[model samples]
Target chain A: MSRLALPRWSLIAALSLLTLAAAVGSLLYGAVDLSVARLIAAASGEGDRVASVILFDLRLPRTILALAVGAMLGLAGAALQGYLRNPLAEPSVLGTSNAAALGGVAAIYFGLAELHPIMLPLLATGGALLSLALLFILSGKAESPLTLILAGIAVGTLAIAGTSLALNLSPNPFAAMEIMTWLLGSLENRSFDHVRIALPCIAIGTAMLLWNGRALDALTLGEDAAQALGTDLRRTRLRLLIGTAIGVGGAVAVSGAIGFVGLIVPHLIRPLTDRSPSAILLPSAIGGAALLTLADLGVRIIPTTNELKLGVVTAFLGVPIFLLHLMRERRIW
Target chain B: MVNIVLDHVGVTLGRRAVVHDVSAAFAPGTLTGIVGPNGAGKSTLARAMLALVPANGAVRIDGTDVTAMPRADLARRIAYVPQGQTLHWPLTVERLVGLGRLPHLAPMSRISDTDSAAIERAMERADVLELRDRIATELSGGERARVLFARALAVEAPALIADEPLASLDPGHQIDVMDMLRAEAAGGGLVVAVLHDLTLAARYCDRLLLIDDGRIVADGTPAEVLTADRLRIVYGIDAAVETGGEWPTITLFGRAP
Candidate 1:
């Protein structure tokens, strides 16, 4: 036990450093490069006006959003995996993000989002909640990982189908194209307003997930044993479902449906923490922030005629890592 | 130390009664074995005591209705080792055992010195101290069983209920587990085990409750409960029961004619 603590702490520390570096990289490396001196001058209110506007107003919010959204996805993934007792369980895998996306698309399609900006996230959160309720109803008490995943796939397919139908039926092609880009997920051009919209929901949701850490640990013994250990399984399930909805909902609203960070982060960090579900929460959050921020950074730096989509980059990075982990730890399932 | 009382406890699953009108009292400082045929509701009855399953009648722990008691408080009084050997995560043995301290912890609080001591002691008692750092899912069947046993022991609850604790263990580990249950009872905790092995049950249990079709058919000392007539009637087998040794031994010959 004494031996285990040191390495986990160091891993967390390393992840924190990586996130910090990523944040700094997000701030400094952009379309218009700003030196450390220029950034300092901007902070002190004496730099180029364009540089100040770009640094403070543009890059900072985008960077913070990346961190917050990444952390939410990561934490939600860990919590869902722990609650479901399935290593492959994540927001994307469970169709919550797609559901949220459908909700956001519906809000835009119906012009409710034009009435109020918060309507998108609220509707997205509602969509996520609906999907979870559907999942519970479809899967029932069996709680088998396969049934849950199949149900999730069904829900995801339905939501995606709905989204596509809405796009196809839209009279305005430009609007459809715009929504498609947003759905593809990018960290570009987001201001503090998007951050304000997402931060509270993400923060609250993340707190809810983290609060159930001990319960998740107890759950490693399975539902019956966990209840015997005094874990309120029903309450834990409620919190997990609601928490993932709010976090992933807000994330999907602002940045579109980023995939695989949640799936990849926990599995990567589980070994470092001796596979204790509770111990993996914080590291998973930080690791997620690092991964998404780095991915976002990669999208910015890669010299493409059209900038790479954030979601595409993450899926590219994450799917291979997930498959590798699957191959390496085939016995885990 | 607390006593558990089940009064007319009945469990129905989807309009079908799985266990019906069963009543029993389990006192501290005694190890009781519940022996029964397959699907005779032994596990269900055990689960009902801890309110893991909803039951028709009352189950009380020291005069308090278990359903009325808060989950954590009941957990403080009872620790359960479930039947299956399946664990979802491949957590280290020490970490898995440490999960027993959950009921005793405040939400978001770290493990205290007392929790650590209890965990260490449980691992030592279960003889899994040497395997503390090993990944639990990677352990052999018997080894994983022992690790799970240590997890239950770490709870330090007044009553311990184990469902089929000897199910997959070899003879030596089975004996070791039975002895551990006996030791828990001797140490002033109520220990109830759902066991299929009549010989082991007769050997270690201070009392035996034999159930058939979810009803307690015989409840007495091993010598009384393991009678040839009862064995033939309940199990449809012919058995020679020996009471000369310190532990009652049963030798099965053939089908009852």
Candidate 2:
């Protein structure tokens, strides 16, 4: 009968439609607007060459990336929260994003990014994996959620310190400016090359995280009971860790640490689901895509001296809602 | 019917041995109670038998080793209800009970008619059918315990193991749960419970296992294992045992000199 507050399929379909609308808005609403007629012609490879170039070369990649990166972050966040059984967990909470940012910054600092086009994402993914390994070592046989979160906080703090040290020891003002701009995080001018690098990892990682839904459901009964119910907690934990690392790793490598989508999107959509950890994943992913694409549009639409950073807009939007959530759930907390 | 055998089972948590080298066999159609004083490792021994803890030697169910069995397969055969678990998520009572069907269903599959019926039966059996719509986190301690018991019953497994299942319940509910366990045993299910109440153990259990310092010090019928001398040695108290009625009743006098 009425098992769920909101039916899962309806919520998914609604969020999917919203994500599509936001994606369309992202494609059309830019500094230069290409009309629908021109856009269709360009997509089929026949109309105004300039409009065609703008659609294919610039907007399409940015649109696709915003959707993919946002989906990855949202999925990763939901997975982490389910795995940790903690509402406070997110993609960056485990230090993977900070580690990725550090990796990207190190590439910039050492001038390796200049050597090749693929250097940044490669190094960033490497950093994420390394941090995950260190996380396991730091929280050996992580039997408790508290232990993992503490280790994550420690690793994230270290990675943040490392990134700041790089900023403090800048070789030149231009290089410093370059690092600073990247750290602010944007979807601007992100080519299909960026998408090409991030997509494979995100695609694989998405499948891994999604596969963990049942295991996450079992864990709601607590670890021992879950195990007694035929859940292999060790396997479940491994999948969430590697899945979050690669998925969020790929995303942060491309978008330069776009925060809040991972942290807040699940909270936003959770009330719409049956509130099972599994039921929240798809809606959160779709909602994350919609939010980021819409936020990207906002950054472009606002009349300011410079285009606003995407992360700044998300932080501004996320904080008040997060605080409100905290207030509402204060008794539970 | 399922038979559970623990062959030289031992459990070491960190560097300390919580359950020592223990071997026991439980038959079908019997309610076997594991009785012990606090910190006597009854819970650890139950976990070891269920293969929840990392244990040495073998836990065999129906001639097959539990360690080698797939988790879902094992879960389908034996239902376990662990004690004193806090609800991590605030799911409704019905949904929480439905999780017992997880071992039977494929991933992402909807609950079939069979599952729904099982869930309903479990709720009715555990006497929580009226609490189906209630949020499990908001329930009283006794109600939550029954709700969890309903979750285990929903499994409909051939064997059931419950640790401290009678804790946090009123006397009437405690009697009800003991009756339910006896019914499970009568229905040809192997039922094992770790109990703290000596009178309940003596009344309901077909066999009583008295454990002390991680070892089974006595294993027999309640009258044999719950004598005044064993009570004085194991619990370190003088207890008056009255067995003239239908069941033995133990009354503690004072600490043993």
State the DockQ of every prediction. 0.85, 0.81
TM per candidate comes to: 0.94, 0.96
Per-residue lDDT over B1-257 for candidate 1, one digit per residue giving the tens place of the 0 to 100 score: 89999999999977878898999999999999999889888999999999988998899999999999999999999999998886988788998999889899986678899999999999999999999988898899889988999999999999999999998789998988898999999999999999999999998999999998889999998988998888999999999999888878999999999
**Candidate 2 residue-wise lDDT, A78-140, digit = tens:** 888888888768988789999999999999999998998689888888989889998999988
Docking class of 2: high
Candidate 1: regions farther than 4 A off = A1-8, A110-119, A133-151, A172-175, A329-333
The local lDDT score (0 to 100) that residue A259 gets in candidate 2 is 87
DockQ of 2: 0.81
Cα lDDT tens digits, model 2, B61-94, are 9999998999999999999998885678788899
TM-score of B-chain for each predicted structure, in order: 0.98, 0.96
